[model samples]
Target chain A: MSSTWLAEAFAVFGKDWRSEMRARHSVATLVLFALTTLIIASLALGPIGASPGERSEVVAALLWILLLFAAAAGLPRAFVHEEESRTAAALRLAARPSAVFAGKLLWVASLLAALEAIATPLAVALFDLEVASPLGLLAALAGGGLGLAAATTVLAAIVAQGRGATTLFAALAFPLLVPLAVLAVAATRSALLGGEAGPVLLQLLLYDGSIVVAGFLLFPVIWNP
Target chain B: MRATSLSFSGVSRRFGRVAVLRGAAGEVAAGGLLAVRGPNGSGKSTLLRCLAGLLAIERGEIRAREEGRELATADRRRRIGFLAPDLALYEELSVAENVELFARLRGVAPEPGLAIARRFALPAGRPWGALSSGMRQRLRWAWALLHAPRLLLLDEPFQNLDAEGEATARALLDEHLASGGLAVAASPVSLPLPRITGELDLAR
Candidate 1:
C-alpha cells in the first residue's frame, strides 16, 4: 500500500477510536450480548458434564453462535453511525474510499478483538470448557475475528442506506458468513479436543484472506452510493 | 494556493421519477462567488452536491480548472471544499480533534484556529455535541477553509448565525475571494459577500 493510503487509514482509525472511547456504546452492547447468550446457554446445560467429544462439539457451536449474533448487533454501527450523523459526506470529501474501508476494517477488527478477549474467557469459565491446543485456538480466534470484521464492514455499508438497518444487518450477514462460521467451528472443535488443527486453520486463513481482498476491492463501489 | 474554476453544462439529476435539477448549468472562475437561489425543494442543494461530487449527474458533465488549466474529472474532489447542512462533525470528538482529523485525512496541515475560535467564542476542548447551533456552524466554516481550498461549495452557508457571526462569515468569504478562490453558495436571500458576480436561479 502507498504511504498516503496508510496515513489516511490510520487517521480514520484514530478518529474512530477516539469517538468510540468517549461513547463506549457499541463495544458495551456487543460484550453484553455475548455474555448474556453465554450465561443462558450455561444455565440451560446445567451440571451436564458430557464426554470430551460431546462437550467440544456443543461448546464450539455455542461459541460461534454467540459471536455471530454479537457481531451482527454491534458491527453495523461503524457505517450506520456515519450515515445517520451525516459524517459520511465529510469522510467522502476528505479521504479516498479505499482508505475509509481500511480504517473501518481496522476499527471493526479491534472491536472484535476486544469482544473475543472478554467473551472467550467467560465462556470457558462458565461452561467448564477446555482447549487442548492453546496455540491452535488463538490462531483460530484471530482468523475468525479478521473474517468477521472484513465481511461485516462492507455489508454494514450496504444496509446502512436502507431502513430497519439493524434487523437487515443480521439477515444479510448470516448468509455471507456461513462458510467462515462453519470453518471457525470446525477449527475450534479440533483445538478443544486435541485434534490436529493445521488443515482447518489453513482453510479458515484462506477464507479470511479471500473475503478481506474482496471487501477491499468492492467497498469503493458500495461506499459511493 | 492556485486559482480554480468550476463549470457544468446541461447538467441534470433525478431522484426516482422526479427530476431535481434539469439542464441547469453555470460557472465560477477564480475570485468569484456564484450565489444560487431557489424556492424550497427547488434543487439548489442538489445542484451544489452535484458540483461537490457527492451526487452524480445523470445527463451532463461537471469540470474543474486550476490556474486557468482544465483538470480531469477524477481530480476534482480533492481540489474542492464543501460545507452543507448535512455535512457534520463527530459529536464525540473535541473541536480540536475534529479539525486535526479532517486536516490529516486531506494530507494538509491543520489550520491554526485559535484566533478564529476566539472570534467565534468557541471552546476548543468541548465536544461538538455540546456546542450551540451558531457555534457549530462557525466550526464548520473554520474547517471548510482549513486547507485553503481552490473551490468551495456551500449549501445554506448562513444557516444559523447571528449578526456578528454573519459578519465574520462575510469577511472570511470576502478574503477567500480576494485571494483568488472560487465559491458557490445556495441561499434563499442574497449572501452578504460583496463579490457575488453571478446568480443561478433554480426557482425558474
Candidate 2:
C-alpha cells in the first residue's frame, strides 16, 4: 500500500526502530562507542586553537571513521535480520527492491542522525572545543549523516558477504569515503575557526550528494541479490 | 491464467564445462507436483535452483510469466518459493519469531502464519539453531508455505521427517496442490502424486 519511496523507507525505518527497542542493542552501543571515541579524540588532539580547517579536518575524519565502523557493525545486523530468517526471499516475493532500499536507507539515516546528535555534545565536552557557529556545525552534520548513512548501508551489504567482514568493511570504505572525509574535516574547521565555511561545505555537499544518489540507485541490486 | 511457467530450449548448463543439466527439457505443469531425482552431482539441486531463478541457466532461455504472457524471463520468479540445504535461518530468533519475520518480509497475513506455526508445534521460545533437524524441516516447510507461492521449489522437503512428520508434510503439500498450488520437490522418496506427471531421473 505504501507506493512512494519515502513511505516505504519510513516503513523499513519503523521496523528497525521497533526492533532496536526490543533488542536494546543498536542505539545504546552506537552512543556509547561514539562517546568513547570522543574521549580518545580529545586526549589525542589536546587543547589546540589550530586553524578552523585543522580542527574540522580532525573532527570530520574521526567522526566518519567511527561512523564507518558503526555502520559496518550495524548494517550487517540489519540485513542478517532478513537472511537468517530466510525472509530475504520472502521480501523479494512481495516488495520491490526500491522499497526495500528505501526502508533500509531511512533506517540507517535515522540511526546515523541519532548517533551524531548524541556524539556532538559529547565531542564538544570531551575535546574542550568551541563551535564558531553552532548552527552551521549542526547543519553540516545533517547533510553528512544522511550521505554517510546511505553510502555505508549499501557498502556494508556487499562487504557483509565477505569473510570477517569487519576488516573488509574498513578496507572497502576508506577509498570511497576520501572525498567526504576531506570535505567534512575542512568544513568543520572553517565553521569552528570563524572563516568562510561556504567553499568547504560546497565540496562536502557534492560528496554527500553523489554518494546519496549512488546509494539510492544501486541499493536494490544488493537487496535482491 | 494457467499459473506461471518455465521452458528451456536445448537448455544445457555447465559449471566450467562440467555439465549438470545437459539439454534436459521438461515442463512443470502448473497446479502439479514435479519430483526431480538424481544422485550426488546429478544436478537435481542445480535444476531446482535454475527453475527458481537462483542459478542462472547457462545455455537456455528461461521464460517466466510477465504481464500474463510467458515472456521467457521476467518476474514470475516472485511466485516461486525456493529452499536449499545450505539456506540458513536466523540463529538468535525463536522459531515463531523467525517465521514471523519471514512473513513480515513476504508481507503475508500474520494470522494464517500463526495458524501454520501452531500446526507444526513450533515452539515460540525455541531458537532456530537449537532445533532438531525434523523441527527445522517443519519450520522451513512453514516458511515456504506461508507466502502461498504459485510454485514451491524444494530441495528435500522430506529429508528429516519422521513417519508422522512425513505424513503431515505430505498432507500440507497435498492440500496446497489440491487447492491448485504447484510443488516441484527434489527427493529420493517415491511421493504418491497423480502418477508422476513430470519427473527428471538424474541418478545416472
Segments of candidate 1 deviating more than 4 angstroms: A1-3, B1-3, B72-74, B113-115
DockQ, every prediction: 0.57, 0.25
Candidate 2: regions farther than 4 A off: A1-33, A45-61, A72-94, A161-172, A221-225, B1-4, B14-18, B65-68, B71-74, B94-96, B125-130, B192-195
Name the candidate that leads on DockQ: 1
**Winning model by lDDT:** 1
lDDT of 2 by residue, A63-92 (tens): 767776676666666665566565555455
Candidate 2 TM-score, true structure as reference? 0.82
Q: After superposition, how far is residue A203 of candidate 1 from its true place, in Å?
A: 1.4
Tens-digit lDDT string for candidate 1 (B9-75): 8899999999999999888888998999988889999988888878888999888888767766445
Q: List, in order, the clash count of every candidate structure.
A: 0, 8
